[model samples]
Target chain A: MKKRGIGIGSIFYGTGYGNGFPDVSKAVAQLKSDGKIAIYVGATEVGQGAKTALSQIAAEVLGLSVDDIVFINEDTSITPDSGTAAASRQTYNTGNAIKLACEKLKRDILEVAKDYLGLNSIVGLTLKNGYVYPKTLPEKRVSLGEISESLESSLKEEAVFTAQTTEMDEETGQGAPYWPYTFSACGVEVEVDTETGRVEIIRAVLAQDVGRAINPELIEGQIDGGFAMGAGYALYEDLKIEKGKIKNNSFTNYLIPTSLDMPDIEKVIIEDPESTAPYGAKGIGEPVMIPVAPAILNAIYDAVGVRMTEIPVTPEKLLKAIKEKEMTYNEGKN
Target chain B: MKKIKLTVNKKEYMLEIKEDTRLIDLLRDVLGFTGVKEGCGEGECGACTVIMDGDIVNSCLVLAFQADGKEIITIEGVESEEEIHPIQQAFLDVGAVQCGFCTPGMILSAKALLDKNPSPTREEIRAAISGNLCRCTGYNKIVDAIERAALYLKRGK
Candidate 1:
């Protein structure tokens, strides 16, 4: 016989290393003569779409499309230090740096465009589609190609942003350690096999507070990937260690969820907006996986009346718990 | 050491190899098809997947000598210089390539499946690429990319 139950889990996570720790990230934006914008930073992209999101941020700031921003990253010698790509800080930290650099570049371009357009006041002027022109005057526009020809060399702007945080008192162990916090909630449905203690996830639904979604598709990808990892953590990704040496260290022993292992997933994106974050967007790289394990565990308890404290919730452990519960009931009746 | 003749990406190569050399090493190190990534180096992760004689096999598990007189299709040969393969294009348009370590094998698996079926249901597509391990995008977009690729292939675009 198989019993089914649904469980819910929620969490609030603070992105970036906080607690009065100085968190800084840097970026340099160069306006190429060909009218392409090159963004230089040291943020590593491990397939989490940091480069795409960062480029979107730059594009948002400079009134350019994502295609116009030539995103360059992960080179230490050429690009400046953008810190490590941890704590979900790349979007929040380095994104701000890129935003600032593009803003400066925009100002410089407008300065040159004012002279090219023969405008005394550069107030009504803006950049769009490789042209610098007044908002009202579409006819009196100068292309970026013409703007670059008048310049002696290409224009560049470098900027840096420090995350705001304060150290806590040692005794109290409290302070404003992290900024731009994010929250998420998850619901999971599972079927627990009473005969063999097998558990299967039927469906999963998650609602994430992503401050703002710079790239909605990328966010969807992140949430889906996070759920797979969380499912693995809740089910069967156990690493064996002996004498501090790891056994089952490779994929042959350790396993992750394949496409067949995943259930139907529904993602709900909540965009409340963070004022301090770039384009009012927060980092969700690490927070999306926080709710999956607890929800699955709770669902298992609901179905089979077993509160599995350990991960993997293997059949052996679940069956032992069920047998013990049955014995306690049978003995008490006598 | 042994001598083997194989067709890779429609190119014929007659090469001498050690009896112990795996096809992955031959494709990556010797043939310089670095697109054939070796993730697990074992048969579990299908990162070294290549199409051999119309079947998808883990190149890491296949010895170089086993490929003698066989036809192999790798990521490098998926498209011509002028146009990208529809599957690769769909992977890009759907934003399925993340970290991209598992892409070469994943794409080859999709290619083999489409070459056989041309119009696979979502479940069949899932079953086809289940051996490839991608920790980045989960499997949602990759699955969607394959479905989209099927549309492109059916339309003969």
Candidate 2:
């Protein structure tokens, strides 16, 4: 017999630095001769699209295409100390720093444009498409390239952003862990075969409150990748250790999800913008993986009427659980 | 040591290599093709997949002696001088590449499938690259890329 079930899970907000103590710094420089903008930050891109996402943030601030901005990241010799790439903190911490630095750069450039154009005040002057012009007088504008040529030196600015959080009390062992939280929920449908104890995930619907999606496509990629990892964690992946020695260290025994093992996934991105985040965008890296295992487990319980407490609910474990449950039911009837 | 003559990426190389040396070591260490990554150093992960005489095989599993007189194609050989292959382009267009570690093997698997059957169903695409493990983009985008590449190849785009 085949049975179907559904389950749900959630994640709290977390920054990489515990209690949000570390400060992330970013530097933005506009080249004098070429008028190109360069952003430097110490955030690594581990398949998370940090280079693309941060570039998009910088491009949005500078009013230029992403291709025009050069990003130097994760190079300790060149980039500043923006902090580690874990806990989904780079998008929030480094993003804010880059945004602030770009704002300062724009202000400095507008000052130059103000004096050159003989504008009364800085108000109503906006930068768009590499040009600075007054709101009403579009014709009276100066190109950023032209301004750079006249200045004869590059314009540079840097900023640092630190998130606020309270330390834990020693006696109580309680404290505010994160400044802002990223929430996510996942619902999964699973089909369980009673005879073989093999469960197949049919569909998964995941919803994340991402604050704002700097790049929507990238967010979807994160969600899909996260679900895959979660599915592996729930069904197949296990490190068989004996006497503190890893028995299954190779991929031949330790199974990760393949393309055939993945189910149909529907991602729902929720944009409840965070006031503290840059462009109202928060971190979604780690949050995407938190809720997946529990949802799959819950679905298994709903389908086979057995509560599985261990990770990687393998076929053997499920079969044992089913037998035990059946034995208990028989004893109760007697 | 035995002398083996192999054609890799259309280049002929005749070298004396150890009999026990895996094809992965030969291609990466001797031939300097770093695109073939070794995730597991075993046949399970399929990261070191290469086309050997029109058959996709794991380089880590095949011995250097086994590849003698065989025509092999690595990731470096997939593209021409001026433009990228349609499979690579489709992977890029569909955002299938992330850390890009598994991209070469994944692309080659897709290429092998397309060579066999130009227009494949979604299920077939998934089954074709099932051996290639990518931890980053999931298989969704990768499958999408292969499907898109099939269309591109069908239209000669």
Candidate 3:
């Protein structure tokens, strides 16, 4: 017998090392003499598209396309510290550092533009298409290359972004910790086979609040990947341990979602901007996966009216639970 | 060690392999074809997938001696000098690559499917590449990439 049910799960996650930990990131933006911009930050890209997102942020501030910015190769010796990539902090912490640095760098470039264009004030001057010009008169313009040549040296600006948070009380464990918290809500439809204890996800939709979407495509990809991991964690992965030794250590027995196993995924982006965040964009990496397991578990309970407490809900365990429930129901009938 | 003759990426190589060497070792260690990734030594992950005689096989499970007179195609052979394969281009255009650990295998599996059936439905594409696993980008974008690759291939023809 097969049964189906739909369930929803919602959660909130705080980005960075929360609980009163210091969260800080620094970035250096350079206006190179070659009329291009270079940004140096120690933010490692672990396939979450951190580099791309950061590059987009820097480019937006300078009114240039993504290609105009030269993203310096991240090296500890050459770049400022943007903190670790964990806790979904790269997009917010490093993004803010890059954004603040670029703002300062923009001001530095405008000073040269004001003098080069012989303008009384930089109030009406703006940088666009590799040139600085007045909004009213596009003809009275000076190229960035000319400004760089006039300076005879590159202009550098660095900025540090730190989050303000307070630790919890010693006994009550209550405090407003972690900054720029992200939230998400997920709905999943699943089918549970009573005889075999197989839970197949039919469809999954995640509505996430990304604070702001620096890159919508990358955020969608992250949501899909995170949901797949959550589904696997809820139904398939079985890491057995005995006497301090890990059994099923390899991927052979521990299964992950394959192309056929993944269900239809629909991403819904809910951008409720954070005032303090860079470009009002927050990290969606950790929060996307937080609500998936609970949703799947709830869907399983909804389908067969059985309360499942543990993870994976493997076939054997599900079948046993089903049988016990049936026995209890028959006894009550008698 | 026995000498075995095989054609890889349109190039012929006559190599000597130990009896205990796996096909992956022959390709990666001996021939320096490191594109075939081995996520698991067992045949489950399909990370070491390659085309052998027009069929996709996990190189990790095949013995080197068994591939004596076979023709194999690894990820290194998928691109030409002028441009990458249409499938590779489609993967990029569709945002199907992330971390790229499983990309080589996924591309090869998709290649094998397209070669056999130029026009595949979404279900068929899923069934064909079910053996390969990708943790990033999920499978949606990869499937979309393959569908787009099919279109590109037809237009080029």
Model 1 steric clash pairs = A18-A177, A19-A177, A20-A167, A47-B99
Off by over 4 Å in 2: A169-175, A241-245
- lDDT value, residue A257 of candidate 2: 92
RMSD of each: 1.6, 1.9, 1.6
Per-residue lDDT of candidate 3, residues A65-157 (tens digit): 889999974689999888998999988998999999999988988888988888888887889878998898899998777888898668999
| Cα lDDT for residue B149, candidate 1 | 96
lDDT of all the models against the reference?
Answer: 0.91, 0.88, 0.91
How far off is residue A274 in model 3, in Å?
A: 1.0
Q: Which lDDT tens digits does candidate 2 get at residues B1-157?
A: 9999999999999999998999999999999998999988868888899999988999999999999999999999999999999999999898888888899999999998999999999899989999999898778989989999998888885
| lDDT of candidate 2 over A267-332, digit per residue (tens) | 999999999899899989878988999999999999988999998999899989999999999999
Model 3 chain A scores worst on lDDT over the 10 consecutive residues at A248-257
For candidate 3, the per-residue lDDT at A252 reads 75
Each candidate structure's TM-score, on Cα atoms with residue i matched to residue i, is 0.96, 0.95, 0.96
